[model samples]
Target: MSAPAPPSSSSSSSSSSGLVLQGADDVEDCVWENEGEGSLPWDRFGYVSDLVRNGNRAFRQHRLEFFEKAVSYYTRANQIKPNDPVILGNRCATYIRISQFLKLRSASDSEDRPLSGLDPTIHAELALKDAEKLVDIQCNSVRSFVLKASALLLLEKYDTARDTVISGLQVDPFSNSLQGALQQLEKIHASCTGSRSNTKPERTDDFDCTLCLKLLYEPITTPCGHSFCRSCLFQSMDRGNKCPLCRTVLFISPRTSAVSVTLNNIIQKNFPEEYAERKSEHDSLTNLGGDLMPLFVMDIVIPCQKYPLHIFEPRYRLMVRRIMEGNRRMGMVGIDPLTGSFAEFACEVEVTECEPLPDGRFFIEVEGRRRFRIIRSRDQDGYRVAEVEWVQDVEFPQGSRERVDLLELTSNVAEHASSWLTRARQAAQQDRAKYEKLLSLEHMMPTPRDPERFSFWLATLTKRRPDEKLDLLRMTDTRERISRGLIYLRAEEQGCRLQ
Candidate 1:
């Protein structure tokens, strides 16, 4: 080399001071000897907490570059002090922030927007792994367990989230975060009873409801192993209680059927767009009527009549809770054997009193209000819902003669019914207890001041077939129901005379 430029005074000074310049060979030899010993592990850990805070701030700014720089700092710290609890915790937190930031971005952007990079779930999974590592490294650290549980929750791995929570509680029972997480999980489980499907078929065809000829909506799985939209299946059942696909006999009632949790979840997860559209369509349909009302599938409710109920089932308890939340109104329909569903005509009832028990059961008293006929029906949370068309009495012709004739007819029917009731009670005297019970119930029967309504209630209490009662319930003309009642009463009285 040119004259190896004389080592200036530095060489001369090294000779006097016994200090020699390090050669490349010497530097290479010492590189591994004490690579990171100058920085203590604790120093590296100290930097991690600051890096995590900066990372959080960068994430808030939506500056991916700055966030990534913070992440790099954390990584450097972690490498400097491998497996340091503080470093591991900070790195895990950084990963979680990254995922959250990405998730927020995705939520704010249009659905059709193209993703720029890796999915946020990948980061969430990575964070979950880090959190698990932290938990394993520090078994008793409540913070570690909380972090792990949070990661699992974000991943939508609920069972593992629960396990993480239980493990944390085992270590420290008084952790408020862990307890709150556990309670939240329980609420989710109860509320979304029919959640995600586990054994999903490879093809999308498996999820379709046969009746609707599309994807299942509010799917309920019957005992026959076939799934259908709640409304579609109910409509099919209206013709006959059998599985639509398999034609298997089913004894399911709207009150007792449970929605398939697994299928619901799978549909929500895989077909989010379609599911959202379906939900919007369903909501729009249900809200078409004035304040959609829950349909109570039990005995018919007549206006001004008392409807006492003992609510014990979980589904009914939920229904009653919703009822109390709103106007305390519910529609009551009789179970129609002919249709295999509730009668088309129904009545609305308002809860007047409710006594809730410790076990979520209730003793509720209600009074009937107006009559309605089901225009359409659907299932909701193991209950029936309907779009209804209200029915009212056909007002008599606006004339004195029509009013007089109506009054005369109602009076004649009431007298005939009274005579027939007395004769029947006398005829049934051989069974005095049975006759006495009928007499006792007579006082409890609804007797409105309005003659038309009174005649309707009379027909309600009369010994008649279910179909006959349903006919009386559906009659819009109160006068017609009274005339029909007279004929039935006369036939009953003649039969008694023959006996």
Candidate 2:
């Protein structure tokens, strides 16, 4: 073999091919001279591959500079034979190493926690591009798919990463690498959703909230040297303005205090699995209704009336506490005396105010919002829960005779109710000293002009059997409720005259 000549100073030189060749001589010596031998591309590829192999060894030995040196050789080889899969794959592998090294180094770097110097995201993206090209070149290349998935995973494109792994598994069904990647993705999904994981528990105490003796969720701490789950503390404070453990008076309202940042971080970092489970559990309780609300079965609460409650039972206290923490709303179902469960129809109520008494009871005031018919019922935490679809007023067709008839009926009912109210007011006037409060009923009688409001208000004020009141509550048609109210008012008025 003839000795290779050193190039002139202005010509430049590249010794990556293991030969002293001028940059100007590279084209002629590589392609033209070695055309007959057909070893030019192979020689360049072999030389680059050797550099990449040595770079891999150096990477394992922590020789960081060798990555840059190997990249230079790979670039030269790629320029000589563009789009060569072997060269692209080797270059991509080197880039991946650089990204991994930077990421590992960044963990201890104070300037940035996950990245510094060269952004690993850029390298990972570049590796992804090369991996894509490789996959295009070799449709069934398992290595390319694995590499692409790894790069995507590093870039936090979890869905795409999982899909890529699945694609690889489709091509090579028994690949352990693909299986491992899929498992990692499942873990990530579980962590984000607060679902149970297959891994062992982190620590028992880390996951437990002191008040609930369950997993910590929306955890908060009090100034009285205590920490409890936010909902748990709120419930405790609702009963008595003191901490359950220390009985120290808590001046901070449950709504005002922020979540403990340090504790939240520790829980998220160390007990991700349990934290995910706890979050899922809380969501199931609070966000219960899409179309149906969780019902509180106890009384016959009519719409547009305030229902005051003294929550003392353990189950009911739990129910009210959940209501306060959630949307502050629940369905009020009357207990069916026949079946001992709950009536099929109920009115929804929203908590207007909640006063926590010192003995772990709640003085809660709720106002009715709407009515619903039970679709299903179950028991949860010792209280009856029902899934119910909201009952809206039946809208009569426009210009229909039904609407006109209902209007006429409502007017007649109102007149009779007014007459009953006038008679009651006169009776109270006959004894103003003893019946002072009944005087206000004269003015309040005509205030509820809305048929729905009027019907419910009449039910509350009128003396009626429980069954008859329940019948009014279950009535969806406002006209029917008003007709029943008219009958009740007429009967009462006749009784008053007889008395």
Candidate 3:
């Protein structure tokens, strides 16, 4: 009422609260006293009420608006408190999250060339530099460090990212996301090893995924007579369906037995312990046994379908023999992202049906069991080796896998999804139709309980890389994963239709 004091306030109808304040404000001051520091007493500095408001807004119900406000305010805040660790740390996080949303939006919004350069993931990074400035200011948050590492890694600053995450892990060891990020960087670096000729496993005490060499989970043996997690093999096969070890074709023509009696002699001779572990795990019934599955040192990717794995690679043949006589299950793992050997995450698979081929291969139908994420792979004597930690989301029956007439529900869902796909396809442009169709189906799956079958069915509809399919397969959370699958398939259908 008294001329608004220093006359810092203004009215704006476009924004939520019209009261925009103005005053003798110095951005370098970082903190501004409501009535001037002379009028108030405190070392209180490096923050402003506007910054708080913007931060709060960023986290509020209307997140988009909040983030927009944060972008402007935080940019101003960063300039003033550029070296203030707390301010820098917080601002860094705010930028990263905001940027993530923006980048994703830009990606999805821009079809021909999804917005790339100016995305928030980029801006969030600049904010991160400001955070690093806070190291001298003695302010760092675990969140800040992790985000920084993630940002750097995404930007392909692999070495710096790995170092930053390692430092953060020393400070906070329980950050699983950090662990994943570190592994990702290591995987990239590990790629420097020549080509497939260098694919030999150095040690077998701990097995590495032949493809990426992280940790193994849901480990799947390729029909080509090579073993790796479904995700790892799938990812490699995605580019060109080939064995990670021998470059043998996996999905083309007929898979052969590369494991000759000579190779079996090598494995048995080179590292018996690891070979025994592999054999024991493959043969043991109840596979990994109860909750102990996740606690194990190895992870695998398990597939839901069965193939007559009757190939006569003596090592694999013997392994399958044991698995079939018992649980009839195998694990699927990927190459470790760190060591680039075996990935830690994998799934436990149980065979529901198995029919031996006339050629001694196996044709089987299987269901997924426990899931795992690769942790660390250690070398043994001979066989490719490593320990895996379980990380997949396996739902308790009470959790998301409740028994129901899924077949009927999925049938109805598929029908609804198909209609959406057809319509969106017709409405969208040629190149856009497929993605849109997938999104439509994915968006609709949640309302239906039997979306699992629909999700898998939709999975079959799209010809994605094996890696993409495995991502869908690893989704143990029926409702959500299926929802994702529905969207992807329907979007593809729609996009194709439009074209």
TM-score against native, each model: 0.37, 0.48, 0.29
Runs off by more than 4 Å, candidate 3: 1-288, 291-310, 335-340, 352-370, 375-457, 473-480, 495-499
- lDDT (Cα, tens digit) per residue for candidate 1, span 1-499: 0111112344322122111111100100011122353333343244444554554454344344554565555554444445556556655655554444443442224124423333344455556766778888789987787667655655556677778788988998988767766777666556555554566445467878877778787788776677888666645654455677887755443213435656787788778778898887765544434746688787876765666799876667667765553567889888875987778887788885554442335678887777788888888777878878788777765557877787777776666655655666576678745554444334334343355676665654446666776676688787787778666656655553221
Sorting all predicted structures by TM-score, with the top scorer first, yields 2, 1, 3
The 0-to-1 C-alpha lDDT of every candidate, in the order given, reads 0.59, 0.61, 0.45
Model 2's TM-score against the true structure: 0.48
Query: Candidate 2: which stretches are off by over 4 Å?
Result: 1-215, 222-224, 233-280, 415-453, 496-499
What candidate 1 gets wrong by more than 4 Å, as runs, is 1-291, 304-308, 352-358, 365-367, 418-451, 491-499
* Model 3 root-mean-square deviation: 26.2
User: How much is 204 displaced in model 1, in angstroms?
Assistant: 41
Worst ten-residue run, lDDT, model 1?
21-30
Query: What is the lDDT, from 0 to 100, of the residue 442 in candidate 1?
Result: 43
Model 3 agreement with the true structure over 248-308: per-residue lDDT tens digits: 6443211111122333444555566766765665334224343332121223233332222
